[model samples]
Target: MSRRCELTGKGVMVGNNVSHANNKTKRRFLPNLNDVSLMSDTLGRTFQLRISASALRTVDHRGGLDAFLAKAKDAELSPRALKIKRDIAKAQAATAA
Candidate 1:
């Protein structure tokens, strides 16, 4: 899999590393990603995602996986997360009906 955050779309960044002799080398700055299993209280299920540490903190700040998905922009989410968001919405609708 690519080194990218599924939630925040964070990915590797390109930069140059400078040495003491003013020599520069191409370098890649990778995002801090972790494979995490986030549980949903409404669906009573857990979803595994590869996300950045920042995204995890945001999820926690937003209260949970559901809340984060509900408020996050669709363009910022990965395809898997988009599907999960839709499923959560459908489940919530079913429970309400």
Candidate 2:
């Protein structure tokens, strides 16, 4: 996978660094990405993602991951992770029952 934030769509930006003496060099500004498992207060479950800190901040600002997730109605998620979350929910429901 590319070095990108799944939440904010942040990726490496290519640019040139110019010095006062007119010396130019290549540079890259990397996104602030972090892997975290966030529990959804609404779903009553957890999901992991490689998201940027800014996107995480937006989630926190809105309320939590749930709010962010709700807003991200079209966001993509890994199939394996989705299956794991579904299985966990099923198990929890079985236990509760």
Candidate 3:
């Protein structure tokens, strides 16, 4: 699988690694990604996602998966996450109506 966070779209960053001799080599700063299961209250389901550590923390801080997705931008979400977001919205709307 690609090294990208499915939630926040965090990806590898390019940088230079400098040595003591002033030599620089290209390096990649990869985001710390983990496979996590987050529960969505609106959909009443758990989603398995590959996300960055910071994004995981943000999810918890925002209350849960549903809350985080509500605040997340569509451009930053993966296709799977975008689908889940739509499903959650539909479920919540169904409950409201």
Candidate 4:
């Protein structure tokens, strides 16, 4: 697909590469993305996602995928991620109800 993080919404950033001669060239800084399968405690399933390294660290720090998704804003999540988030929410609600 695209060069973007499915979790953190990290994408390519554009900047100028400056040379010693004061010449500037366009450059792109891409996020460190990796394909990972994260286990969701609520859904009890493993979901594969493409996410940035930093986002993966944050997920670990936050405890797990479920916890991270709970804290993540809807605006930042991709359509696929958002669907997963909704599924988790529905599962949790059903269990609680």
Candidate 5:
């Protein structure tokens, strides 16, 4: 598996590291990811995925698990993670009021 977030689609970003002497070196900043088991209402199963911490936070902030998943679907998320995110997003929206 790659160092990518299954939920937010986070990946490695490339950049340059500069020094006071104007020296530059190639560098990369990786997203914060975690391995988690998400329950999917659509499939009625649990799937394990690697997701970014930020993506998880976005889901939590928007509403709950279900609502978060819905947002991911709208964003054209990965096929493997779609069901779980959708379920979570819906559940979140329902709980919000």
Candidate 6:
């Protein structure tokens, strides 16, 4: 898989590495991604996701995986994450009914 955050869709950023002599070199700034297993209360299951550290913190801040997914924007999420988001919504709706 590519170096990208599944939840936040954060990927490598291109930049320049400047030396002391004012020489510029190409550099890639990668997101701080971690493979984590997050448990969902509504779904009663755990999911493995490669997410960024900031996204992990955001998930915690929002309470849990369910809340984060509900509040996250579709454009910002990867295809896999978007599918998971849809599943989460379905599970929540089923539980609510």
Q: What are the per-model numbers of colliding residue pairs?
A: 0, 0, 0, 0, 14, 0
* TM-scores for the candidates: 0.92, 0.69, 0.97, 0.97, 0.69, 0.93
lDDT of 6 by residue, 1-97 (tens): 8899887888999999999999999999989989999988778889999999999999999999989989889998888778888998998788789
* Candidate 2 residue runs with Cα over 4 Å from true position: 73-97
Superior by lDDT: candidate 2 or candidate 3: 3
**Candidate 3 lDDT score relative to the true structure:** 0.94
State the RMSD for candidate 4. 0.7
Tens digit of per-residue lDDT, candidate 2, span 11-83: 8999999999989999999888898887776457687788888888887898876556555534453454345
What lDDT would each prediction earn against the true structure?
0.95, 0.70, 0.94, 0.94, 0.70, 0.90
Candidate 4 lDDT over 1-97, as tens digits, reads 9999988888999999999999999999988999999999998889999999999999999999998999999988999999999999999999999
Candidate 2 TM-score to native: 0.69
- For residues 1-97, write the lDDT of model 5, one tens digit per residue: 7877777777899999999999999999988888877555544566777788888778669774555666554454676666555556576578676
For model 6, the stretches where C-alpha displacement exceeds 4 angstroms are: none
| Candidate achieving the largest lDDT | 1
Give the distance in Å from residue 33's predicted Cα in candidate 5 to where it truly belongs: 0.8
Better of 4 and 5 by lDDT: 4
Candidate 5 runs further than 4 Å off:
39-45, 73-76, 83-97
- Number of residue pairs clashing in candidate 4, backbone atoms closer than 3 angstroms, sequence gap of 3 or more or interchain: 0
- TM-score-superior candidate, 4 or 6: 4
Q: Write down the TM-score for model 5.
A: 0.69
